[model samples]
Target: MKHRDSKDEEKVYKINGSTSSMGNNRKKKKNMQRLGGTGLSLEAFANAKSMSNKYNPAFKKKQREFYKNAKYVSKYKQSLKQQSQQIDAFSAVRPIEDQNRTRDVDEKNIKNKNKKKPSMEELYKKKREEEEQARIEREASIQAKKVGREKAEAERKATRAKMFKKTKYGQPVMKYRIEHLLQTIQSSSRISVNNSN
Candidate 1:
């Protein structure tokens, strides 16, 4: 079917329960744009505020407190900046402690440089002490080695004398042939052990 007007057609074919107020409000709001703070006037805002009765006592108190806190924060920032500047100045100039330390080190170096060198008598005394100590240690080691060797030699002689005393030729004949008999016994022992292995 052809419609005489699109508006009438829409009205006739509208939903069974839909309202026209929603459509009318959407069209009206779209035609009007809010110009808020872009066109705001100080005089208009002042008049509006004077006419409004929405003031609360707590709001005034909070505004005053915020102003006081902002002032304190700005003062604190200035103090910190001043303290940092002072620190920079202090660092640029060397402190007395560092100057004293450097002076002390220089003085100590001078004192050490001017110190006396060792005398010939001192050098001779040190050399003699070192040589004496070395000689004493060598003598002790030699004495201990001599005692050990002497003990071992005594034991070997005693063993040979015992072996000779056991010989069939008797103790008297053993005196003459003891050295030769001992050498033969040692050689025979070595040969027997080797052959057995």
Candidate 2:
């Protein structure tokens, strides 16, 4: 005897105390069976429930109310469209009137220009007024700056005076000279007393 299939010998098979010569491939067969006959009807189930609800009087009434609300919503949308068209037409006419009004105002201004030109005195007075206002602003700004500078200078001077008083070198330098003069006066007094004695 000779073994003809080494690959077939690698798999184990047992059925009723006897091994089948072929591979035990039942899993693939069962999956194919499941694909063929699960017996589920999703569409039919949904249709059955919908039919029952459709025959119910309360459900029919609710459906009518829904349809009525939908109709009103569509009517409202149509009215909004018509109102938008009217607004667009009104806006189209408004700009032309606004332009004509502006043109009339321009013509009045041009008519006024043919009258007497502004006097040189008036022009000079206007210029002088502008210059005076500018001068006043500059003077106020300069006054504020001067006040700040003076305050800073005063603070610096006070700090400097305080630092100078705290410094060791600011002590009296003539202390030893005064002590020497005192000793000389005492010695002269002793010599004068001895001479008098």
Highest-TM-score candidate: 1
TM-score of each: 0.34, 0.30
Distance from true position, residue 168, model 2, in Å?
Answer: 9.5
Candidate 2 residue-wise lDDT, 134-195, digit = tens: 99999999999999999999977875554445337667445554655787799999999999
Q: List the residue pairs that clash in candidate 2.
A: none
- Residues 1-197, candidate 1, lDDT per residue (tens digit)? 76477676557656555646657777667665553224448996777678655764578799999999999999999999999999878766988888799799999999998999899999999999999999999999999999999999998898766655645644354554667778889999999999999
What are the clash counts of all predictions, listed in order?
A: 0, 0
- Quick one: best lDDT, which candidate? 1
Q: How many angstroms is residue 65 displaced in model 2 relative to the true structure, after the best TM-score fit?
A: 98
